[model samples]
Target: MLIINIHPTETAWSFVDDTASTCSIHHYSKPIPMETIRQESRILYLISPGQNDLQLAPEEQRTVSQQAPHIQTIFRDCLRANPRADHRLLSENRFYQNLPPLSTRYALPADLATRFQRAGRDALTHQWAWIKAKSILPEVKSLISIHLNSAPNAVAIKNGQPVDLSAGFSQMDGLPGFHSCGEIDPSLCLTLSEKGEPPAAIEHLLAAQSGLSSVSPELASFSQIFEQPESLASKVLSHQLKKTIGGMASALNALEAIVFSGEITPALTAWLVDLLEPLTAFGFIPTSTISCESITRLNSPASRIQVFLMEDTPWKIAYEMFSQAQPLQS
Candidate 1:
């Protein structure tokens, strides 16, 4: 089987042998023959982020560069609400999992989530069209399907489902985002609004202009903060990541391995490991580092848990999804 991953940032295609392992891999360029897809039994696994899983008709395949105001309206609705939690709960449970519900995250309204999904429909369809234009294959076009799986950075398969997600979702209740503020005190939103700060203004500030950039003038982007390790931006990011990973592990009740795949994650590895190892008390350090032209595992002997460095997680998950799905009758 041939697995081609078209991610938001990079693209890679791999040939898988009988053992279901990648045999040969090509990166950032198309090396395979276009006729090969039509001539052989193959599947194309696309990992276009922020795209819906529903396949669209060819006529509906145009992408939108600007998000409609309505979408942001729905996003802003998820921001903050009237204050509710008492100070006692906040003070007593400074530890993760025990922190007040309003501290790190909020329950996103279902209708609002759906609205966001609907708004991105055209964008996802446009992505499929873009991939097809480059490949020039008609036979396997229908084979392209959406993997409902999502995650912040990498793709994780749990309970037979993909866990990929866009920003503003609360998977990382404790993890602060780059420009968007990290998890915050929910009531803070209410207080800000009371002082004449509109809900929309707060949302824009958090989503567009906060986090690392809000902290200091020098750190405007993740790359900027990445370069300035001793700076305050790096310090806060490190703290937030550590807390979030620990909280997630605790909530899930298991911690066996870590896979890092995303636009920025693979690049921020050494820094992430330093932050992860201290809080994690596990003893199963990786005995050897794994690497390949295609897929590989990173992590030195002292680091615990098998660490996989996938070129593209969505593509991997999409392949698994397509392979697992029952074919439809003609």
Candidate 2:
């Protein structure tokens, strides 16, 4: 099976053969020749992060592709590269067959970070965290998983499936990311535009120059913020994260677990869980300090809710989810 994950900044492709041999390219440096893939009879799946959660009709697909031309071009080239190979659009119920599409009354916009709210980015960042959260606390009925990364977002899982997300019409709507201002008043954007700031310039500022990094120019990433917990940037991020988690928790009547994932080191996990200890209602009191490991259990055995820290790469998680959802013959 071959899976290609598409993102705004980069593209990644992975090939897993019958023997489970895996080879991959994770940057936009070079393109994979379709002829190599067509040499064997195999399935090729093209995936765009949050798009998998939406069920679109044939016409809707065309509309969405038009809005996201980069994605559309990739799909077109892949199709032409291997005209006879089995190609799948791996979206909506096509992947994660057990999980239903999120329920919402509003019509979803195109999958662009700038135009409207979309999960394509969040799906890449949070889907794996959601899967890891469920695996760690398999029996929890209601759960909230927080992903702190370059493009951070939170997911509310009920009955072991995603039911809600913090991301709004765009990746910029949810929790503030490393550099992007998560949620802000719409009037502020208009105010900037009226001041003669071009739309592209405004986007670059909000999506690239704001958020945690804005608090302290020296702190460029979440990793750095966690490293210097006493820094102004770290303190500001801590305050914001606590508030975001609290708001998400309110949406669920009965919360059982809180899992932390994405671009975190073991020290960051322990530090974050300790900072969030005030939310006693969700059982975050650790019997002892969490160990600095890739995966750690932070809660005590007697707590009403379980707290955990697990780390896994997004690409690995996405490939696993897709492979499991639609297994192909060797």
Candidate 3:
């Protein structure tokens, strides 16, 4: 089986053998070759961030099936609100679980294929958050996965399923991402358009030029804000992060843990103390930091809620999913 993960920043593929043991892997910063996909002999599966036509697990497929009717209305509302909104968000509600597997004989629709090429790439850190929560506390029922990277999101997990998402309808609606504008009043977008700004230009400004970097040119990544903690950019991000996480934590009826994933670094760990201060009222306290690709507990011993750090990338999870689904495909 061949698994392909396409992101805006990079593209990767792995060819796994029937036994799910070993396979050749290739990842490139350049676009994946169309010819390679067209010519591959093995069955192919795609895992793209923010893609709607996904081959979700059986459970997710069932959820999509039950809720599919509302998607068209959601898409229409988003378009009416933001004329230049990215199609990925509007289209993501559909499930492609029963669709034909990618092969020479079966091709993706042109629009869906283009989204795979343009979707923002993240580690799918929410899934790892759930894994860490389950590992540390098997009885854990509810937790929120906070991903603060190029494309930030907070997902509330309950019983191993997503109960709420901060990146509602689009990745542009959640906490301000490193580059994305996050949410803005529709009136503001309208105001900009009235001032002679093209809708396309406004969309590019919000989607590409806003967020941390928009606050300060040096704030390219989440970690860099720590270098100038006193800067306006740093303060803005801190406030936004705190507000977003607090709301998510408050939403859950039985919050047991909080998982911080995606772009976890030493700077982020060192800053967790101050970052989570407000949340202490919610029974979360900061603890010592451990930097690794594996999941590690980051909450103090006395804290009632568990806090974790998971730095593992999404590729590992994608591989595991493909491996598990291989037999079902047969």
Task: Give the higher-lDDT candidate: 1 or 3.
Answer: 3
| CA deviation > 4 Å runs, candidate 3 | 6-11, 15-44, 49-124, 288-293, 322-330
Q: For residues 74-105, what per-residue lDDT tens digits would candidate 3 score against the true structure?
A: 33533344343222321112221122222111
Alpha-carbon RMSD, candidate 3: 12.7
Cα deviation at 71, candidate 3, in Å, is 22
Best by lDDT: 2
User: How does candidate 3 score on lDDT?
Assistant: 0.58
The CA lDDT at 309 in model 2 is: 70
lDDT of 1: 0.41
Q: How much lDDT does each candidate structure score?
A: 0.41, 0.64, 0.58
Error of 2 at 135 (Å): 3.5
Q: Which ten residues in a row have the lowest lDDT in candidate 3?
A: 89-98
Candidates sorted by TM-score, descending order? 2, 3, 1
* lDDT tens per residue, model 2, 147-248: 767766677767655666666655566677778887789899999999999999998888888887887888765788788888887777677778766766
Best by TM-score: 2
- Scored by lDDT, model 2 comes in at 0.64
Candidate 2 has what TM-score? Answer: 0.75
